[model samples]
Target chain A: MDLVFAYLDPGSGSIIIQAVIAGIVALPILFRNRISAVVRTLRGGRAATPPPPSAPPTDDRPR
Target chain B: MSAPRPGQGLVREPGSWRDPAGFVYRRDGAIHRQIAPVFAAEWEAYLASGLHDRLVTRGAVLPFEDAPIADALDPATAWRVIRPEMLPVISWPWEWCPGQLRDAALLTLDLALEALDAGFTLRDATPYNVQLRGTRPVHLDALSFERRAPDAPWGPYRQFCRTFLAPLALMTERDPRLGLLLRSFLEGIPLDLAVRLLPRRTLLRLGLATHLHLHARAIGRNADGKGAEARAVRLSETRLRALLGNLRGTVAGLRWEPEGTEWADYADRTSYSDAATAAKERIVRGMAEAVAPTVAWDLGANTGRYSAIVAETGAHVVAWDIDPGAVERHHRALMASGRERITPLLLDLTDPSPALGWGLTERASFLERANAELILALALVHHLAIGRGVPVEMIATFLAGLAPNLVIEWLPHEDPMVRRLLAGRHDMAGGIRGNVAGWPLFREEAFRGIFADAGWEIVERAPIEGSGRVLYRMRRSGRA
Candidate 1:
């Protein structure tokens, strides 16, 4: 099927530009922890890993 | 919205008008989404793909039953009408806690990737497409997914960025209050605005630099044009998958730890004794059980102490507070405990979420959407009365309008919390000119009289020992 599928419309182009830019900007921020971990390992030191996120204190009981 | 036909018995929802694929309508107290003719092919493909079933099984997508309305409103454009399971409550992105937004962002990315695997992709990445089914995030827009082309970039990428990524980034890095910007920007925060408000240090972060700063510039360059120049850039399936993976990774890594704020650690500083707290809990529990409401709203649900107790009766509770930190902490606790009956939202009762969008009818206001059977205003009246300076009668009027059954805690002026709220007050009855006297004392009779005038019948009144606070279980007259 030689149908000319104009999938990328004007509206779509605008959306694409936003996504591409956002995706590129997000790469470093999102993977900073891993990036730092790798950098630490290359310098012959263990990565300073953060502890797992904990639940908030549920007990609102007074002392 | 289009005018309702003479006797079709259908009212099209205002918010869903933006999407060309279809519009949702309410007919005889049931929700139905109509598939338009333009999107018929896509809709057919989506049903045949089995992805809907897969998503429904995971509780990721809202499950719908195929109930085709015979006498269609406009049969010319209507393709297929299906009835969907109505969510108990509809919460917007601006009201979500940081943890909830992060989870929603991750869920969108996950669903997009999964859709790609099944030869379809989400047409848009708006957070409005997702809604909370309790603590769990559920994708509500069934028509959002369309057949994906081999090397075409994701269409909803920018929307996803604006709606989910941008808000999440700002909330995580700068201040959680930044999430409230969504209420202002109905179409999601502009990239230019986000980049400007972000900290200078964020430039060091690669994600912020490229996506926000650089993305803003790109958008600026193509502002006058229809993005025709950049339309030639074809993103392959491999790259698209990688893109989704990156989004998932970034969203997953962005965590906002709820640090102690004014009301986040309120429970620890309260003057109530252990026995008093227990007694109060028992009273609240007993009152909540008596109402046996399907939905309950807990106003000023700081750290969700009483909200959790209310949820014990198997009622879906919406824990609302002004402090983002408190809501965030409550949300995290709920998530950790695997409790899915309560939703913690940041809401200032004074200036609640307003009815916004076209003709101010699209996204209903907090009070409009929230029509709970039971309302719990525990330890909240003083905040509105003294701190915010809302008159007692006005508070009673608003509370009465919120629900039929209400459990409100009234603290006398002598109470430590109320005193602290009034300590720095110089207004003193006569507008800062007359005597500069101390805070005016709030009497129980005055409070009771106000509620009575507002058509509330007091059912049970319980007092916390040594706290000078009274809890009233009041039912609106003519409602019971």
Candidate 2:
């Protein structure tokens, strides 16, 4: 007999689904500081001036 | 492992069977976890990770020992069996006060950060995975850790938000009574629900905005097609750490000072004279020392005064009270003192925690876990008898089922506290006096007769001077 195991039930699966989408939108913002640095270097300028450390990503952009 | 003896069956703890990685079972009063073959890779990697050692060292996780038990219920499925050190008392999230829940949430985040540092991630973040080792929250699931993938988001993010962040946020911003919401949503408080309940000002807080409000909106918008499409998304380890740090900061910052409850100031308003209070304390202390139980349950343990007394004798005491304010105060004291033997929890003795979740066995009820060798009912019987209108016989029967020996107090109807509880209440008898109608036959002799009939032998009884309260040390019949 073949046995199948499900690690994620519906509740967990749904959460993972939502978290995945949020991750897509949030990850770039999370690494915006780093991304800006790389972008500046590609344009031959120092990475976009790193945001003040006190400032968290305050962007309310829709995902 | 060896074959089981004929007719010797293993008892799988009902609440623990849900997690597929393993199931907790008991044999001859010993608690064991059976790691399944499906979880072998993760289990082996976790054992080698030193993360377990780190957590066990700091008492963050309950330590277990690899043991070769005689048999497994299903040998084909069992990869390894380990015997975990049993916690004296197991409690749930609903029973936790605001402070306890916050501490637990912070513990989960701390462990998550540490696990990420160790190249592993927690698979889930259910509050149920955490249990109190005294006042400290200890993670109980060994298989919850999995090898971390580079640039992968934390798998338990939603769970953490629902179980820890949302509840803490509610208790901090709203009323602590919102903590009871966990009793219904066994999985967790839906992020959407939390967002709706929280005030608009909370949106200004980054942690609340990112983890709860925005997350709820994201979940709602992506309800059908979005999650599957976004599975390919990845988060760098640095980003994951930052997320966890934000959660930890939020949890650490949230605080609620327990106040304005009728029972929070109980000890201050007590009618006992100084001499009588000392005598009562001496009696409780003497009885506790006499029994010397390894585990003690103090029912209605307001602020845990007697519980502290029991703990001083090297016994683990689960101090339970219905009043959230009192439980919160007791928990704060326990945390401040770093008391490692007393656990304070919120429990309504009249309506205890019931069987909940799938098949109604996911979480054990109060009575299922209330058993202890020594039980203290100080100043509690009257509350159950008069405050709740439970008959003395029913209360005795329930208390008898909890422990073999009991230290109980009987407050006469004339006692000030009892009178206050009975005041202005309609009497059931419909006599000219309105107060007597609802009052049951709570006479001292009747109470003793009920306990005696319930199979308890009174070991010692005393009336404190200056008060009409009688304390009895009753031993269950048939127990030495």
Candidate 3:
């Protein structure tokens, strides 16, 4: 990151793609998280809370 | 405009010219961020809304303190100047190994997601906004966040793809060397280029397909202004969250194994006998402990075997290696072992990372950001001296500028590694194939005079018994 903040270009094409796929791009993740949340609830939410849509997996490591 | 102009006691950071909200400058030897009057409101809200505090607590961003109003060096341009925590070293995305880059990408996505909850948003997403301390990354750009733009498409959508997503996919699917493409495409690898290089099977991965292939096509289509409504499109916070989630999943799913790189297995497959290796390690450990430097650079640090030893002396070690695989593996090991002192980076000394971006100073050249107090050149001299055909004189001069003390090794021609390298070369003047009598690197005479001329005086010299290799802990004489 050379020293600048993105003075926020949000290129036209990228915005268009996001517009085209925003509805379905996250379906699988949404469904997976929803299912996991329900499972956690059914298990009485002992150690973990039903996470929000954007929360990282419980631990920080993605690998 | 109250912008930072040339010729002030304040030296505006080179890469800061791109950001309109604010720019960082050094005045009186302290880093101060000068916020333009236009961004004053947002800067205030960033603190009042407690976003700064929240992110600081999570180690998400570099914490800062508001300096007294009188301290503003460029009062005309400075609405407010705040002092930010100093980042000891800055390593660019090109030098980051896969794991480090992956971690940086994750941090970018995570910050964006967290910002949304506070009714604020990340106006842009780029790896440059983040800095790594060891394996941990912290956001560096404070001006990227703003109150959410309702009904607006995520402004940094392409920036994210170009800067993070594309290179990541290329690295995981194509080759880790493609990650070095960041050096060429500082804006991030072009999506179309990434799409072309990625295997066709990647189209099956939904997130990649949409963000890369479809994204590239959309950009191309809009290049002609056909999608005039791209700016008019309304993205609900819900949909935006969905987009963020998708990007996170795609990035998290991308993986690159640190195996099969040229030097990944070099440590275990040694040219020296077990006794020689052990003797070398002991010697390196003793010398590093004696110096006890705060920071050490292990040039050509293959697997960080010696870097780990240097760090044991309680120094923060920056382990740089030419091999991406070796750096990646070393970084992963450090992360797994919870060691935060050794930062493994990808660097090819023959052609090191340069000061690039705006004015070629925004991104610092490798030498520009060098933070070594002791340099470990173990088993590395021969490679740079012969493998790259760089003369010992230039090599010594370069090392002199990197640190005040040095632990370097000299391998004679009879040494198996040098012999293996020499077998392929007929010329030995000073290059890969130069005539020997002119400059035989195998002899210390090849480097001794050059080292002295470069202002390095040998403090101690120890020869590895049996391997015929010599180790010297040298003290630098002049200023680096």
Candidate 4:
């Protein structure tokens, strides 16, 4: 098993780990906000109005 | 040089035992460092503070990345990952010409000074850590430094002196070529041995007095079971800074001008007509277009005149020559031209890099690591053939193993240069011979017969206009 792991490209391995960590960290925050909105609506609370979508096009330049 | 069996978990390198911290082989073609669990936090702190980055940026140390601790079977143990930009060759200190060795020594001291300022000290000081990357010194041991111990004296101080200071002092004061001591002693020269070899007058030099003389005395006192009282000499940070300054001053003062090697005189003596030289350059460029090698090695590259032609075609080239003066001038030319791809190294092909360190497994041998697609061995066979008395078949056999495609120049005895080589030697000759006896020299039949015996298929041959020299492009065939 150690020998098999050693043969894998280090750059490829680092990229895979980075992706996995990003997904794991993002999932919890996404689920919590969705749950809070649903609960507030069930309690007959007024929904928070959405913000205006009049913002300029977002900058997409790479760092 | 033996290959390990398929399932071996971690093939502990034979050379690893010399290092205090264990080094292990990973299957990915990279070496990993495994520090003791006690040093784990210190290693992390050292990396987090940008010390590694600073050293690497300065070319003082090899760079590494933090590896997951869980990678190890024992979660308690921690490790670091280093993917070293592979060197074209691992030159032993013994093989280094005087100037090359001096450069390595000065670079080591420069790294030590920078490392100390980064709040860490080197654990081991060995010349093996310094490797030449394009005529520039780059440290190879990524895990050599650790967080300084507040209570312990600087651990590697004496070692630094032995590995760099003593060798440099001997080369400067006595004979420049004394750096060859590295070959006889795998580790740096022993301090006691260095003390003996140095002249009595060296004892009068202030820097040598304190470092080599007193330092060796301190080690001797400790060995004699002298009380801890004698070992209690401590230095303030200010004094330590002064010591480092003194070392830097000493290194800067010692210099050697590479001179007096046969090939160093080659540029002035070369017999090529201007048109012939230009034609040779065109042939090299055309060959480079066909092969398109990412990396090429030019063997016997006398001052790298033809190597530059291949370099112009956008290939990284390692121009190797046996002559120190020639290599020095070649390196200077490449530097002045702002050419980053050409690396000139001093090497004698008669005896190449051997497997070194314990059980001969620590460093890769010469042929074990070779560069890419094509190799140019132009105008060099005569030296190996007539000068060294090596058979043509033997020479072909060696070149075949090094690269897939070879551009070889066959200089017939009728060539002026070939006549110059034979001017002094006994004329017992018939021709360049194979294992079998009695052959005619430089005949086309003899050349073909030798290449065939060595399992190389001649692909192309072109004769030079003004000389009997013919260039042959040969492809290696599958036969051992």
- Against the native chain B, each candidate's TM-score is 0.94, 0.93, 0.91, 0.86
- Candidate with the larger lDDT of 1 and 4: 1
Most accurate candidate by lDDT: 3
For each candidate, what TM-score against the reference? 0.86, 0.86, 0.87, 0.77
Tens-digit per-residue lDDT, B95-120, candidate 2: 99998898888888888878887898
> Residue by residue across B1-480, what tens digits does model 4's lDDT show?
668554345444455555434354453454555665554565677778787788788766766555655443233544543335555555666655555666776776666556667766666666777877766667887666666545324445555676677777777677655776765567567777888888998778766766676666656545533333434544433334445556656566666565676788796787778777777777777777677777888999978887888888887788888876787788767657867667787667888777766667766677876855788999888788778878778898888888888888877666778767776455533433221123434777788778867888887777766666777777777765
True contacts kept of 3: 0.74
- Here the TM-score of candidate 1's chain B is 0.94
Docking class of 3: acceptable
Tell me the whole-model lDDT of each prediction, alpha carbons only.
0.78, 0.79, 0.81, 0.65
Per-residue alpha-carbon lDDT of candidate 3 for residues B1-480, written as tens digits (9 for 90 to 100): 576554456676778777778778787667888788888777777788888889899888999888865667667777887898986667888888878888999999988888887878887789988988776888987888887767667888888999998898888888888888899888878888889999999999999999999999988877866446764788877678888888898999998997777899999888989998889989999999989999898988887889988888899888889988898888888888988778888888888888788778878898888877899998887787667878788888888988899999988766788777677666653563444434556657756767888899889999998798899999998833
Chain B TM-score of candidate 2 stands at 0.93
Provide interface RMSD per model, one decimal. 9.8, 6.5, 4.7, 22.2
Q: For model 1, how does the per-residue alpha-carbon lDDT over B60-112 read when each residue is reduced to its tens digit?
A: 99998876556444556778888889988889999998899999988898899
**What ranking emerges by DockQ with the best candidate at the front?**
3, 2, 1, 4
lDDT of 1 at B298: 96
Better of 2 and 4 by lDDT: 2
- Runs of candidate 2 exceeding 4 Å displacement: A1-6, A9-63, B1-9, B424-442, B478-480
With a 3 Å backbone cut-off (N, CA, C), the pairs that clash in candidate 2 are A37-A47, B427-B437, B427-B438, B428-B437, B428-B438, B429-B437
| True-vs-predicted CA distance for residue B326, candidate 3, Å | 0.1
Name the better of 1 and 2 by lDDT. 2
Binned by DockQ into CAPRI classes (incorrect, acceptable, medium, high), candidate 1 is incorrect
